[model samples]
Target: MLSLRTRGKSGIYYIRGSVSLNRQTIDVKEFSTGTSDKDAASHVMAQYQMQLHNELLFGPTAKVADVTFSPEM
Candidate 1:
């Protein structure tokens, strides 16, 4: 159950949602800046994706991995 919302004033996107995998809860929180609702949604989605990749070690994220893909690739 992922949820996305925009801040009332700053119009920043926020993702304070949860995901269940194998009975495990992965609660993610992320934020981004934008004006329109669509932009805010996209911002949250992008932030969440970055979090997943970096923290959860998804793929080609920011970490010291034994193997990594080329940045250009």
Candidate 2:
């Protein structure tokens, strides 16, 4: 699971969480979303989570296209 939080006084949103694979838990260090907007931060968090999931499922050499986050029209 992943969550978003603001750090320091910059108000920049960060992504932090852990993933469980093969009965082992791996920690995902806090990553800066580089945005102050909550919505944008959520998008970033989703993309990162997806990437982690794919890497765990398909190995690190898996060739996957970049994930983009866009609001539905």
Candidate 3:
């Protein structure tokens, strides 16, 4: 699950969620979206969620491999 919240009167939205990997769940406390606008923060959150999902499915190294090299070549 993911959620957005403001902290310390900063008015900036932050992302908080948990990621499940290898049957273990890890809590992501807070990541700053660096924006005060909710729409922009939601966009940032969506992008970040996709990134986390990719990392979960393909592992961190797959991103580098997909960009730099192809095994089927």
lDDT of 3 by residue, 1-73 (tens): 6789987676999999987767756477899999999999999988877667667788877567546654895
Tens-digit lDDT string for candidate 1 (1-73): 6666777776656666675545456676654444447765776676665555454444344445434577875
Ranking by lDDT: 2, 3, 1
Candidate 2's TM-score: 0.76
Candidate 3 residue-wise lDDT at 29 = 86
lDDT of each: 0.59, 0.82, 0.81
Candidate 2 residue lDDT tens string, 1-73: 8899999887999988887668656588899999999999999999888777767777756434554578999
Clashes of each: 0, 0, 0
lDDT of 3 at 23: 74
- Which candidate, 1 or 2, would have the higher TM-score against the true structure? 2
Candidate ranking under TM-score, highest first, comes to 2, 3, 1
lDDT of model number 2: 0.82
Q: Supply candidate 2's per-residue lDDT for 47.
A: 84
Against the true structure, whose TM-score is highest?
Answer: 2
